[model samples]
Target: MYGVFPYNNVMATTVSRTSQKTARIDIRLTSEQRELIERAAALTGSTLTQWTAQQLMEAAQRDIETRARLALESEAFDAFQAALEEPLPDEAQQLLARSPQWA
Candidate 1:
């Protein structure tokens, strides 16, 4: 029955320090997964809840920062700047001139 589901890693995050916890999450895992999580918790001297929260936050922040900026080589950046510096094409400028102006 246990072999029927897929297990990635130990990610137990429900057991917090306080009894008045506001949220709960239920998940299934194999013995190997459980042991791995416990070992990680022990190494960090943090409970399951703390370790999961910290790791989740770190990953999310990293993802956000990665997306916020484009990584380009120096040559690519120079080309991009050059493109911006160039004027719009003659047809595009003519079309803009014909469009109605707003007050």
Candidate 2:
């Protein structure tokens, strides 16, 4: 089933190393997609597995960092800071004066 792509030109860039790899991930792709990735890997002197793993890791890190950050414009940031500096309303102050009723 994997006959169409030429695999002879790909080379492993890194020296032989061993690690405890206990997890497995399975994915399905079209032959064209596989061939494209294989070509890219060969050009970068990386094994297909290594190139794919690195790409996945970089993409995941970017996604996580983007989600974790809160970006605000300068005017909005000033408004937010001003709100924090304001005192609580009278009703809120009264609520804080009461003792907690624990069951």
Candidate 3:
């Protein structure tokens, strides 16, 4: 359940996302998937390509964010590690202790 907070690393600061139609990528999807995407695109009033691109960008952002690592000051690091190492609450410990019996 620990969140890997971001470190001080950053990608190049691009002034803006490219908007020119300068590249092409092809993706294959099952009929059902394509239908679902089409429906979603219709709902958002965007073309299939536009909707797909937006969805891809959003997913990529989430993926990168999750993989980010924490870079904390020494004091902050000590505090964070201290918090993580604290014991689970009694009720949670009790529930975990009983989990094996459920199986």
Candidate 4:
């Protein structure tokens, strides 16, 4: 497993690495930024690399999950459902009847 560490006295888990293959990513940061990150890593009892990777992975997962979901209030959902059930306008129906140009 890569980038696993103890945070707040609790162990963090990650997927097991099945092979020795690895890749590297590099970034430049100001000294102030580095210090802040180093301080956070120290508090979590993780090395800078482990802490940075863990945070990046968690943030990436959160972003992906957010993008994958849709939420609507009950009234809004009902309106959306009604719109889908409504028949297409004559112009739209005529368009649908034609063979697609791309096809």
Stretches of candidate 3 off by over 4 Å are 1-18, 71-76, 79-103
Name the TM-score of candidate 1. 0.58
Candidates 1 and 3 compared: the better one by lDDT is 3
Q: What is the lDDT of every predicted structure here?
A: 0.79, 0.84, 0.84, 0.88
Best prediction by lDDT: 4
TM-score of each: 0.58, 0.68, 0.51, 0.64
User: Judged by TM-score relative to the true structure, which candidate is superior, 2 or 3?
Assistant: 2
Tens-place lDDT per residue, model 3, 1-103, is 7654344122222323444477889989999999999999999999999999999999999988877956799999999999999999999888887858547
Best by TM-score, which number? 2
